[model samples]
Target: MLALPAAPAAAGDIRATVRDRDGKPVADAVVVAVPSGGATGAGIPPGLAEEDQRNKEFVPYVLPVQAGTRVHFPNNDNIRHHVYSFSPAKTFELPLYSGTPTSPVLFEKPGVVILGCNIHDWMVGYIYVSESPHFAKTGADGKATLGGLPGGDYTLRVWHPRLEGSEQATARPLAVPATGAVDAATTIGLTPDFRARRAPTPGRGGY
Candidate 1:
């Protein structure tokens, strides 16, 4: 029998754990991996993402997306919300209306975009726009997996809503193999989340 050509090596997964300075599992922490050789902006799919406004809060709390992602801010509450971001990465507003705006906001820059609501001062969210597509968010257990990344050297970094220092301060070099999974761990200092603590609308029971 004739020999068939060898298949290209498959991409792998990068699993990471994030812990606070006190060794507590840090949830909603985003870990991003940028290619060390400066080849990025291709692995990530450019499309749609959502940062929902529900229960007087931004649903995901922390969202990680690649640059060029169009994120929809859908307000599902009975009350209208004025969603806006004053961050240098993205600054825009959806003037007081509910039920998914007609035009989604595009995230064209790579940085930390802090989201907030004018009407509800307690409402807050975060969007981490990564330069590379290889990234993941830590779960309640502080574990996150960046899957399907081709083997290569990467500059790994972590970001959190209340991180104490600049995101760049957590940078570390990583070497990913062409196959199988890699494990990484990072410890960071987090500042207390000082978001306004407003009482939920009488019996509404919200965050």
Candidate 2:
């Protein structure tokens, strides 16, 4: 009989906090830590085949998964929905459907994926599949810590939906020791009017 192997221990940790010019915490900011050497395939992530459905909207609004992971979209609403995205990470669509699709949508690369429903124009969602395992999304207080990072050189980057400039512009190199804390920070100017509005009622006449 064969025995399963033990899981690898976390080598290090990355404790990060993001704040604006006024020193106030910014919530829902995504922080990604990409390995400099471009060596992926470390360990298996916790979740896969995540569900993004039309409950009159995208469930998570923002999803972060490992590269090569599959995502599922099930139409939970009564009406059918056509989901598609123009993001470079992955570009595909599911024609109007009521139940779960037979095959899962796979994200082959590492980048942010923006989703929208063709039938319902107001539906919007994001999928961020990272190449590196060391990454985390900031909480309401703008604090995120990525533990279990192997000690090495890495390029850490920050991304937001409301960001105006390039994602590469906000990137900075990070060096994590075998066992210690490192502080990384950044401030980005966001678009002035950026907010999500409720979708219009289907078949509602124009004013």
lDDT per residue, candidate 2, 98-195, as tens digits? 77898889987989999987777668888888887777888888788977777888888877777659878988899977677777877866666444
Please report, as a residue range, the 10-residue window in candidate 2 with the lowest summed lDDT: 198-207
Q: Which stretches of candidate 2 lie over 4 Å from their true place?
A: 1-10, 45-47, 193-196, 204-207
Badly placed stretches (over 4 Å) of model 1 are: 1-8, 200-207
Per-candidate Cα lDDT values, in order, are 0.88, 0.77
Candidate 2 lDDT at 39 equals 76
Model 1: C-alpha RMSD to truth? 3.1
lDDT of 2 at 37: 74
Candidate number achieving the greatest lDDT relative to the actual structure: 1
